[model samples]
Target: MKAAVKRVPVRNPANALTVLRLVLVPVFAVLTVMSEMTDSSLRIAACVVFGVASLTDFADGWIARTWGLVTAFGKVADPIADKALTGTALVLLSWFAVLPWWVTGLVLARELGVTLIRFWVLRHGVMAASRGGKIKTMLQIAAIAWYLWPFPAGLAGVGPWLMAAAVVVTAVTGLDYVFRALALRRSTRA
Candidate 1:
């Protein structure tokens, strides 16, 4: 006789919010591109949608932890939802020349590389987010938000500067994760 595998529920509030954020990615992307139109309303709408979607990220995490509804689905999907949102925003902004490609490249490289390393070391143990990682996330989100907003000419330099800080934090945190994963893999090998 074979035992059936038990599955974790993927329909929790946290996962639902995570999925909602994912769904909003394309909507956000389209709005961002449309914001390029002559109408200022599109730009404002884009930013508002982005801001609401960003809020869900924090809400999902908080609700999951506070309500004791955390699950493996939330763990995996939440980060992917975040990456999808940030990655698309970065890429789209770069496409429109609002952001420099180099900055987008740096952030994407770090994010993608760290994500790969996370899966590679999954068998060893689960890696927890460090304080630095949290800071990196916040900086990235703030920078992206600033970029999405249609600020005036006087404040043009702010987004790039924030992105520069985000890039630095992202790189540092990525390296930290790599080292942690390697150590975990080493310790588990014995």
Candidate 2:
């Protein structure tokens, strides 16, 4: 007789961190809006919230993989939570005129396209995150934090440079994903 497989619970600690990240999104947004691009204390608060949320993004995946608590719910919810947090921050930054609208638009477009590609190739194969894609995510997080923080005027210039690098990496990684997804789908058909 075959032994039954033991299932990992959906309510595991890794998933809890993902949920926490999702919950922090709106709080971050609220604090950012209240800061109005000049209030240092509120901006600092918002920055702290953003940092904590970003850390959860890192921690959740680590905990899930390390502890063998990966679940179907985690597979779906984790990316959704990540995108929501990122998209919200980009939008807020653009709204405050701290970052260009085009920057947000391009990054978000690439992100949305990548997400669709994932769904498109889901039946064929899982498209793991590429090194370039991982770098793009880290660059984006760093750029966003740099912009969110109430840095001194001299240091303020660094955020734009970081964001420019992020945009280039984002576009490059997006094209790579598209090509890989097409290949994945084609190979599965053979």
Candidate 3:
């Protein structure tokens, strides 16, 4: 006997939100890097855009899971949107000299590498985001948020530390995922 499969449509509210987040990626980067984060108004506007995009990142996933609207597109585009938003901000921040080149490079490398691993293992099976991956995402968001917001001089030093922590989490989770993907790929071959 064959097991029955349920189909989820590609077009849905959840997917729409995911696409919206993707669209916000370039906008957020422009707002962040245009005035070089020096103009207080531009910085604030960038933060608002980043915050809204980040919120949709969570909302779309929640709505999809809760309403059974999950789809292949969501599985792919959602994560892409997330990486685009965070990666763009990190790259732009580094370009503006607000973030260190090493920090941006390390974080983006881990993000892009893990995303590649996901595609690599997709032929074997879909690997859901581990708990550590979720932690890494939240930390990245918080760290990015800290950098975006203009704070008092005394509190400004905390931003880099947060980013450092996020980078650490990103590296750890990225390694974990690579290992899992390799194992899955081997299993499929066996």
Candidate 4:
């Protein structure tokens, strides 16, 4: 007897949201680069767009679960949108001297490292986002948002602390993922 296979379609609301996020990336980047015009108005505009784009990250997942519209495209596009938005923000922030080079480098390294691990694990099977990974994502968004905003003088200091916390969480979760991947590989080997 032949095994039955199920196919998941790509046109889903969640995937649409992911595409929206991807579109926002270049818009945000353009705004950030134009910061010099109108006394940093562009940066503020970029922050607003970036924040709205970030919110879609949560919304898309929620819609996917609520409506049962999850698809492989959503799975892939969502994370790519997240990394592009956050990575672009980090690069822009570093360029503007809002964040140190080392800080951005470490954060970018963690993101890239985890993505590679995910791909490696995918060769065997799928791995969902862990609780720690979610927390790290939240922390990263908060830190980037705070850094972008130009209000509340004292709140400016919060960005660095949030970034630091994010780094710690990112490192721990990344290591956990690597270990899990290794274990999965071993079990498959066995």
Worst 10 residues of 2 by lDDT: 4-13
Worst 10 residues of 4 by lDDT: 35-44
lDDT of 2 by residue, 138-166 (tens): 99999999999999999989999999999
Task: Say which candidate scores most in lDDT.
Answer: 2
**Candidates 2 and 4 compared by TM-score, better number:** 2
How many pairs collide in each candidate, listed in order? 0, 0, 0, 0
Error of 4 at 23 (Å): 0.7
- Steric clash count of candidate 4: 0
Off by over 4 Å in 2: 1-3
Which scores better on lDDT, 1 or 2? Answer: 2
What TM-scores do the predictions have?
0.90, 0.97, 0.92, 0.89
* Alpha carbon lDDT of each predicted model: 0.86, 0.95, 0.89, 0.85
Candidate 3, residues 57-155, lDDT tens digits: the string is 999999999999999899889988998898889888888889999988998888888878887888899899999999998999989889888988888
Candidate 1 overall lDDT versus native: 0.86
Displacement of residue 79 (Cα, Å) in model 2 is: 0.8
Q: Write the per-residue lDDT of candidate 4 for residues 122-177, one digit (tens) a residue.
A: 87877778999999999999988878777566867888899999989988998988
TM-score of 1: 0.90
When 2 and 3 are scored with lDDT, the better candidate is 2
> lDDT tens digits, residues 19-87, model 1?
999999999889988777334677678777777888899899999888878888899889999999989
As a TM-score, model 4 comes out at: 0.89
The TM-score leader among the candidates is 2
